[model samples]
Target: MNFVHFATDIAHVSGFSALGLFIGLLLVFGIGRYIGVRWLLATESEHTSAGLLDGAIFGLLGLLIAFTFSGAISRFDDRKEMVITEANAIGTAYLRLDLLAVETQPALRALFRQYLDARLEIYQKLPDLKATEVALVRANALQGEIWSAAVKACEVTGSVPTTNLLLTALNEMFDIATQRTVVALEMHPPTIIYVMLFSLALISAGLAGYTTAGIAKHSLTHMVVFAAIIAITVYVILDIEYPRLGLIRVNSVDRVLVELRKSME
Candidate 1:
């Protein structure tokens, strides 16, 4: 698998990664403090000359955190919206199945039910990407079968109005499925941005430690709190990004589809 896929897999268990990051930050913080104390003793200086540089790095870190957190929220909202859209589209098409001849309705309705199940299963399978892929393939195949069945029924009904209304709905239903798949898989920011965020966070932690060198005693409380806050923020961002695999999720929004499926029965 590519790095993106690998990273996504890691994000599936974001809690562990966040914990690891927290530990690493604390270690780096201590190392930075040690180095700073040594340098202070050697130079016998009261203050460092890199205040401007420190400010710039911290500023950039804050900016990146804000942007990434904002973007994750936006994507999380979009995923929830997409779930509602798909549910609506599928419901519309299912109702329009009535436009077909009565004899054709049962078979098409059955296919619609199966198709919806496949769609739900795609995400419900979760961090098992292979199972999700299988579910997706099943869904795509069901889409083709649904379209073909709907077209055949329309031909039998011999009503242009019925064909237009029913086929249009089916087309929308199918289109939205593809669109939802794209959004779920490809809507994320580039991996490099996340890498940069992580790297900058570590560097800033080190600088923060260095700044405290002039203090007579190191503040363990401040160091721990700093690391914990950043680690938690990063975890939340990643959790929001991969809703299916993480604690922050859009699965609740999927109840719309579940209700629609029940209505079909």
Candidate 2:
């Protein structure tokens, strides 16, 4: 995988909070050190304009943080809902299996069990592309099996209420699975947005350090606290954005799917 993909995988596994904090502090401290060195070598000028620019940039950062944070929260909620919806769809389809003829019921139910097992396995292998792919292939094959069985059963018996119901439920089950998969893929914000946010943060920190160079002594406490706040905010944003990989994960909501599987048993 490429760098972006590898980094994303890492973020999903352990999240970016600690890393973000480290980078934030490093930028603040490094920039402060640079400014202190430069201040000693060069004559100082009024920092009024610098202060204005710094404030503007910081304002932009705040706005961007709010925008991304809200988006992350919205997507997180959407994925949670999708999990519940998918579980319901599967449950409905499983129950509809009762509508099938006696001989067809057993085979179809077995396929349903396999399909749910595969679905559960998919979540269990998150951030593992190869394992997820294997699970996806298994799930798709089982879906085909279930679809074929349902169709064959419908063919054996002419148009009837049970046949129609089973086919409809099966289609819904498959449709919701596809929808949920798409939502999962879309949970991330564009990577460029993250890059822009990080760049802005670094620049703002540098400007803050430069503006403080006029002071007799720098306030390490203020700089550290400021950087820590920004880092924590970024961490929270990332946590929400990458729900599967972050501290604030959607894994808890997956209990719906797990319980549905138990009901199958």
Candidate 3:
């Protein structure tokens, strides 16, 4: 398998790994806090050095999260744009079918409808790589059917202009299909990047917790809030990165394709 497909195979694992890492970091930080308190009591070191270390690590974590989040958002927008572009390509191909002979138009239009149905199903089955494979196979078959019919029509009519227009539109539609597939597969950040983020988060959290160790009657609520926020932020980043995997998705953008199909009827 290619790198993209191989990475996709582990998509679910990576997603769940984020959660696991978050929880693991929380536990480590808690334990570190306890140890830190003891160390502080035993040695009575100045808080200034600890506080500086905490701020630096925490700043690094924040910067990493910001970069990851921005990349995810950009990819999300790209997926949305791909949907719109593909929809336009299909709609253009459907309209150009009118240039073909009446006899060929009906069969080609029917193929277009079937192709649309399959394309829509492909998105609906998202995050299910196997189901998507099935849908894509069906869509590719329909595309072949449409192409064959268009070629024969060109041969029969010997009309260069009309044939060129139809073929060009169909070619674009197919190209967009391939582009969409690649974009979907490559949208995620590498697993290693996420692993690094998790590692840094753990270290930063541990230091923060350590800072709290020596203080008497400090609010535990702050730590809880901090951990929860980090967890939720990481979850959102994952959700946006893999739009098909979580509550966040590109399904809403399917409306453009849906409308194109409706107009065809």
For candidate 2, what is the TM-score?
A: 0.83
When sorted by lDDT, best at the front, the candidate numbers are 1, 3, 2
Clashing pairs in 2: 12-245
Q: Which stretches of candidate 2 lie over 4 Å from their true place?
A: 1-21, 36-46, 128-130
Please provide, for model 2 over 167-255, each residue's C-alpha lDDT reduced to its tens digit, 9 standing for 90 to 100.
Answer: 88888899888876654665577879887887777777777676676677877788877787777778788767665554566788889
Give Cα distance to truth, residue 187, candidate 3, Å.
3.5
Evaluate candidate 1 by giving its C-alpha RMSD to the native, one decimal.
2.7
**Candidate 3 Cα deviation (angstroms), residue 262:** 1.2
Candidate 1 segments exceeding 4 Å error: 1-8, 41-49
Task: Give the Cα lDDT of each candidate.
Answer: 0.84, 0.75, 0.81
Report the C-alpha lDDT of model 3 over 59-146, residue by residue, as the tens digit: 8899999999999899889989999999999999888877777777787888899999999988788666687778888998998998
> Under the 3 Å rule for N, CA and C atoms, how many clashes does model 3 have?
0
Q: Cα lDDT of model 3 overall?
A: 0.81
Return whichever of 2 and 3 wins on lDDT. 3
lDDT of 1: 0.84
